[model samples]
Target: MSFISSPVDWTTWTPVIPATLMFIVKDGRILLIEKKRGLGAGKINGPGGKIDAGETPLESVMRETQEELCVLPINPRKLGELWFSMGDIPDILCHVYRADDFTGTPTETEEAVPLWYSLQSIPYQRMWEDDIHWLPLLLEDKTFLGKFVFEGDSMQWSHVETGVAW
Candidate 1:
């Protein structure tokens, strides 16, 4: 199938503002999930989802983690953001967060299978392509924001910055 390019007039493509939560550890370990269904189905991702109206990015992250993994995240720090765009398609404003400590054990929901992996050995093959770009910074204890262009599941290019601290 022919792909739709970005820069398409704002008349098409729905807006996708997704928020993600990554629980980080000192040894480079991170919390991840195996998708149970939809879109990025079957791939691994941090616990997160669409940000609802009236909820801050942090609130969304916390809610999503609780809903998706049955865990209560503690003090989620806003590490960075990603403005995903391609051609003139649409925009997915993603705000990323990190919180290694939390309450409760990770459990599966209808959305994902909770799991963890060492930072040095994250299963990148099972995650969205863009994750490999900025995940390292977060694991390094540095906060940053990133811009990425993706075609379905592959990244075309990326631009990032160590954004101001929150």
Candidate 2:
């Protein structure tokens, strides 16, 4: 595959948008969502959204989880970070978290439909291409940082480092 290089230098990159993603893993199953609107719509991913002004990443993750899945993640732990450069679009920095427990039921909303998949059967083909590269580190409870450049939905270039301190 031919890879496109990022125009912006990653070492000095700053994201125009900051977001969060939370996965609730329990009993060998992980909770994900079929996003119905906004970026990554029609794809399966964790329930999360952009962080609001004055909201910490943790606060944003909890709020987003509740808004998208109607569940309050309990004792959520930060797992990693993902940075994306999608062509001319501004860069995005997403903080990822994992919650082994939560309150309430995973329900369908106008924004998303929650689904549980076994850890061994995560649907990578239905998610962003970069997910297949870093999600395994998340499932293994490893800390990581992933950077990627994309053209539309296709990943052009990528880098991932595990055991990274966030």
Candidate 3:
């Protein structure tokens, strides 16, 4: 199930795990997190986690955001989907979302530390390599689909397409 090459057959690819990520963007800043555990620990990213049994991606995103950041995102909208193949780990499919509003304060938890960065100041170097390819599209309110292959913390290959519908 390796996808460490270009022109991956995405139509036939299936993920072993389904996850979600949510970003709260407002006032020229986006809410990100310094992950404290699990995959991508110590990296900056949005609040999200694996989808629980019987839970929709949207439900998982909202639940994860509250558990990690103590905030409930308002009017979150689906923006894109990402598929990842990391060597030695099961394939993952992540649903990404964005919300312009939220209730409650962004607080740190055992899972993550809340952080806000201006649109022009995203610290890409400290985030996942694939983020640099598709995050811009999310900020511009464009839909996207991305696939990536990684070995450890280094990305081996990637494909990204914008203006996708669902």
The lDDT for every candidate, in the order shown, is 0.75, 0.92, 0.93
Q: Model 3 Cα displacement at 67 (Å)?
A: 0.1
lDDT of 3 at 107: 98
Q: Candidate 2's residue-wise lDDT over 22-121, tens digit each? A: 9999999999999999999999999999999999999999999999999999999999999998886778999999989999998999999999999999
lDDT accuracy of residue 86 in candidate 3: 80
* Runs of candidate 1 exceeding 4 Å displacement: 1-18, 26-28, 86-89
Residue 36 lDDT in candidate 2: 100
Candidate 1 vs 3: which has more lDDT? 3
RMSD of each: 4.8, 1.8, 2.6
| Clashes in predicted model 3 | 0
Give me the runs in candidate 3 sitting further than 4 Å from their true place: 1-8
Better of 2 and 3 by lDDT: 3
Candidate 1's error at 6, in angstroms?
Answer: 11
